[model samples]
Target: MEAYFIGLSFVLAAILYPLFIRMLKIKNIGQYIREEGPDLHNYKTGTPTAGGILFILISVLFGVILKVPLVFLLSLSLFGLIGFMDDVASIYKKDALGLKAWQKFLLQIIFAFGLVSLESTKPIFGVEVSRTLYNIFWIFVIVGASNAVNLTDGLDGLAGWVFITAILPFGFLKQDIFAIIVAAAVLSFLLYNTRPASIFMGDTGSLALGAFLATFAMHYNAEDALVFTSTIFIVETLSVIIQVSSFKLFNKRLFKMSPIHHHFELLGWKEEKIVGIFAGINLLIALTFIVYKMW
Candidate 1:
């Protein structure tokens, strides 16, 4: 039964992307290449974007059909909604800048807080913790994971690969059909999202994937494993933080660009090479976690 649903999600995503891309093209809605990004990316301008909407829809629809808990679906949709709004704002403005950082953060926190508030205020990792601190920690996990995946989406097929690997262990360890379905759907998305992409997932896809990861961790008591599974995202986010801090405090630039993948791009690394290496690393991390758990 799970296999049937997972296969259905894959086919659905495969079908939805081209249709969505055509609709976006007809509506004259497309991606706006960032001014500060790699010059090589200029050709990607006007490519159909916000392709993440299709997978998010599939996940939610399947979640409903499967009778998966509402909280998980809510988390996915809320974050996807945030990403959708950001994508729309970026397209409307004709620039890569979408919602302000603070605006997005505020929205993420509000929704994350609401989600965690409903969770039991039990001791974390068997350590007694205050309710305030406990809620704050989970909120941080959700918000942080959302932004981390968003940061990692710089390269073609990068986030999609990492998201699949990162989420698969959760599916396997927890016997979660929903996680499997999400991963299968994302795998389908990668068919069109690879180098010389036909459509970009934009913030909508990346943000929702991150939120789903965090919520999945919370749902399965796998928060510790998530830190390992999401190493690629963490590193990508850290690269941006380090670059900004170094330039601001020491007046020295650390990398050619932030988000580490762009740094590799500036080093003349091919998009395929960068995605391959990063996804390989993410796969290793996820496999290691799986081994440790099964052992």
Candidate 2:
């Protein structure tokens, strides 16, 4: 069943790729490069946006068919919709920035609350955790994961590969259903999202992917392992946080550029090479966690 879903997701994504391209052109929906970002990214302007919808759709289709869980489907779709709105706003405003921080946070909180409410009514996997704590944890998972993926989207295919690699630990724990579906979806997205991407996942796909992984972690009681599993995201987000803090606090710079990847780019590393290095590190971390769990 898992293999079938994987293959099915790949095929479905392949079929949808050209259609998405047409839709993007029809709607004139594309990305805007931030002036503050690396000059290398200037060329990426006007590339298709909202490609993450295809990824999310593929995963939801398979997940629903497999009867994974209502909460999973609801949470994934709800978050995806929020991301979709943000993507739309970016394109409409012709700005690289999408939703305001407060706006996005409010929407995320609503979705997280909805998931918590659902989980409270029918606890997933029979795991016992207090409702209030669970709600708080869910908020962190949803918001943290969303932003992590958003930060990791610095290089082409970097976020996709990192997400795919992170899902492996969950698979190893036999908590494979949600992770498998997510892996399949990301694999499908990678068909176009690879180096020289045909389309960017934008906020729409990244946030959805992040939220789904967070939900999976919560479901499996593997939230503890998420730290190691999501090491790449943590590192990426930390780089930005540290950079911002240092600049504001001391007028000092941490990295030549934030998010760590741009620092590598400024150091003469090609985008593809940086992505490969990060993805490899993410894979190693995930594998290490899986091996430790087995022992």
Candidate with maximal lDDT: 1
10 residues in a row with least lDDT, candidate 1? 117-126
lDDT of 2 by residue, 1-295 (tens): 5677777777788888888888997888999988899998988999998888888888888888888877777767888898899999888889988789899989998888877676643243456667776787778877889888988987889989998888766676766666676687678778888879889998888888788778777666667677778899999999999999999999999899999999999999998899889989998988888889789
The alpha-carbon deviation from the true structure for residue 179 of candidate 1, after best TM-score superposition, in angstroms, is 0.3
Q: Which regions of candidate 1 fall more than 4 Å away from where they truly are?
A: none
Evaluated at residue 247, the lDDT of candidate 2 is 99
- Which ranges of candidate 2 are over 4 A from the true structure? 120-130
RMSD of 2: 2.5
RMSD of 1: 1.1
Clashes of 2: 0
